[model samples]
Target: MDLTPRTAPEAAAPSTRRRWVPLLVLGLVVAAGGVLVARFLTSAVDYYCNVDEIGERAGCEKGRSLRVQGTVEDGTIERTDGTTSFVISFN
Candidate 1:
């Protein structure tokens, strides 16, 4: 006579994937968050520079927008429509 206990069939057991679905989704969310933070850090640098460093500083290159620390020349700050033009002196 067989003494081994009978076992349930494979179809009766729960799928292994049921336990990993939530973990997989959590991992994806974490990865996406990391990417967003990295992008923000790289693009959010507002370089503070002097007017004399326009061409001498890497962050103050031509056509690049950054914070310039200097005196705005007399009558050089002009505001027309949506644009503002200005010139600064380091002296």
Candidate 2:
């Protein structure tokens, strides 16, 4: 009787190779999705508006998204239906 092992069945079976194919495909898909999401988020436009800049910078076209910062004016807050809107004042 020989004591040599028969190459340990080639380190992996054919069924295992097929299984790894799907795993490799899934990993590639996830990597591509992440890259696409990152690119989309980075390419998106961002606008910033300060309290003083709002009045000074006019001609802002309608339907443009913006971020505004200011202090709420006294006696100018109005609330309705669980939502609140305020008039901001900047010195």
Candidate 3:
């Protein structure tokens, strides 16, 4: 029986294909994960500030979840029924 091994081209073909398969699969997985994370983070919550730019562009209204930046009004801190409230004045 002839015991000579296969030629170099035959041996190299399978090795090259095996090496690239895992790399391609890993790249696809990472891309999918990135898209999922981006969608989740953006949809989780929306933040809006009631400061100068936002307040001027839009208007300030009550019962809106907002971030307000202003100077605390003097003598406006009051405690009523164990609940504290303060008034702020913005320029």
Q: Largest lDDT belongs to which candidate?
A: 1
For candidate 1, lDDT tens digit of each residue in 17-52?
987899999999999999999999888878888888
Off by over 4 Å in 2: 1-27, 39-47, 52-66
Query: For each candidate, what TM-score against the reference?
Result: 0.69, 0.42, 0.42
Error of 2 at 67 (Å): 3.7
Clashing pairs in 2: none
In model 1, the Cα lDDT at residue 3 comes to: 100
Q: Per-residue lDDT for 1-91 in model 2, tens only? A: 9998676545555687898999999999999999999999876755677767754675333456667767899998999999998897665
On a 0 to 1 TM-score scale, where does candidate 3 land against the true structure? Answer: 0.42
> Global lDDT for candidate 3?
0.73
Give the lDDT of residue 7 in candidate 3.
Answer: 70
Better of 1 and 3 by TM-score: 1
User: In candidate 1, which residue ranges exceed 4 Å CA deviation?
Assistant: 1-14, 79-82
lDDT of 3 at 84: 92
Report the error of model 1 at residue 65, Å. Answer: 2.6
Query: How much is the lDDT of residue 12 in candidate 1?
Result: 60
Error of 3 at 82 (Å): 8.2
